[model samples]
Target: MDTHPLFIIIDDVHPILITELEKSGITCHYHPQITRNELLTIIHQYTGLVVRSKTPIDRELIDAASNLKIIGRYGAGMENIDTDYAESKGIVCLNAPEGNRNAVAEHTIGLLFALLNKICIANHQIKNGIWDRNNNWGQEITGKTIGIIGYGNTGSTFAKKLQGFDVTLLAYDKYKSGFGNEFVRETDMETIFAEADILSLHIPLTTETNNLVNRNFIEQFQKPFILLNTSRGQIVNTSDLVAAI
Candidate 1:
């Protein structure tokens, strides 16, 4: 068994995952929860690090990790990881999306349905003893155009999950092309805004994508559209969403 301690920092990981990794003969320094100051203090000691969304992995942490070999992410989206610097120093950064692909995809669809149906509003009204069923009739997702902004693992999974819904799934990936899948019909932003009735954002938040959903895009949308932003909060501008919603 490999007994050498692979000094590590795993944030936002469940207890079960730590136990499994430890059982595999790798010694893990489990700081299950930590603050920035505490992290800076303890991070230099670890050679391996695992992370989720709770902590930000910046250049300071990477520079301090002299013995660091790899950084493992429990979910998809390596947006927080400093990939260019890691590659410059030969550190392996990995994300395990295969574990929760179906979960995120299902959750996205569920959120869309809830939004369109006003599920929370319906539940609240019923509890308050208001029983006008006609007032709460919801819009159907069938045959509507859905614009999917990103086409990564989650985006692709979301596309596959939408097959049964019978809606037109139009997708655009900034870095990807030739998305000729049967489940999703590939298109450009102009076409999406002109035609989509429901726009589901699946893009990552980077400098380019920050506030990608802005007033301009909102104004361009020809339909009284429903928006979905389960991927990243910043991808959809908070101010724009507030204004539109």
Candidate 2:
């Protein structure tokens, strides 16, 4: 008798993944809208699992996956998945951190330009028949100090994108170092806090990073700065951010 591995995909993914997996004799069963209760009912039947950020792969779900061998996260950020618990059960956890690096970097640049130029505000005013160009004057990024936290995939790509601009780039990564180049200066948080005119966060959400940007963190900056957060929302304290704003 011949047996094949069965994978249950609970989220929508590119069709190429299914095609490639099927080519290797792996059976892929896609249930993009399956509920937690429904998944729990038949989880033990599949040998592999795939998901995006919609559901949390918690202890209960891991326990229910009796025959599960691998858990594939379609995107970055493993906070939604209980990786430690899954690994304890000998299940391999995987994620595509670099999959959307360019997309995120480009979007961050678009947001930066929109914020500096007040594009959204201007658009809204124009739509409402209130064209106030005098008050909506924009700032230039030519000589601003840009601070970047976390110098991984998206962070490095963002720095690369800013190379053409005549702005100072300072990046700090607690887990990495010695990556300084012509465009980016690898530095410390103290220097960034003292010099940065624009701040960007690219780190993942974890116990230490949860609410990392609070009132105290915001107050350390020497100047009022524009903040860009493309990572998890939980990394910033909502009330504190509102108060700061």
Candidate 3:
């Protein structure tokens, strides 16, 4: 009997993870550009799988993975995998949200800062040899209310990053309770809608989240808010988001 575990990575991942797996005596195969049909043909050989957003592990692919014991997603999102069906077949699916939470939090803060300061607009204007400072006065982040939807790894990391800033933080997660800390106040959606000057989404893509943000959702906000969505693109209807702006 072959006791060595075989793991196939169908997407690009950090070298450290692959190195660590190799050190553990697991045979690792890195195939960043593996096609769907190619993957189906070679699926039965691996005991474990590593993936990112490049491949969709649908029911057909899962059915072909006869020896697949586990599937590891490099980042937070696992919408590409058929988790329910995989689990039903006793295949454990996992994700590394904690690994990139800080990076996501920092990048989100940077984007929010750039938007609030009119940095992008100013940069474009400057590049075109136009400088009108008074007309492009930017908003200050201090004293602003930031409402975070989905107080998970990324959300909590963002709240922690905002601790130094003089801003009010509110977090709401339907699946959670008592998640509030010194940096965030646990609140309901209605309160967030009424008081948030900015809203940030950090939820995963699921059946309940498909087109979660729409025209009606935007209209409920008491004031026009700077919306930030670092989650899946499908979570917000692009047309509705454009109209909201």
Best by TM-score: 2
What are the runs in model 2 whose C-alpha is more than 4 Å off?
A: none
**How well is each residue in 168-194 modelled by candidate 2, as lDDT tens digits?**
999999999999998999999999999
- Whole-model alpha-carbon lDDT for candidate 1: 0.81
lDDT of each: 0.81, 0.96, 0.94
RMSD of 3: 1.1
Q: How many pairs of residues collide in model 1?
A: 0
Which is the winner by TM-score between candidate 1 and candidate 3? 3
Q: Would you give me the overall lDDT of model 3?
A: 0.94
Off by over 4 Å in 3: none
lDDT of 3 by residue, 1-245 (tens): 76889999998888999999989998899998899999999999999999999889999999999999999999889999999999999999999988889999999999999999999999999999999899789899999999999999999999999999999999999999998878799999999999999999999999999999998898999998998899998999999989777
Considering lDDT, where higher is better, how would the candidates rank from best to worst?
2, 3, 1
Candidate 1, residue 141: Cα displacement in angstroms equals: 2.0
- The per-residue C-alpha lDDT of model 3 at residue 26 equals 89
Q: Could you give candidate 1's per-residue lDDT for residues 174-216 as a string of tens digits?
A: 8899985887888898998899988877766788888888898
Shift in Å, residue 59, candidate 3: 0.7
For lDDT, the strongest prediction is: 2
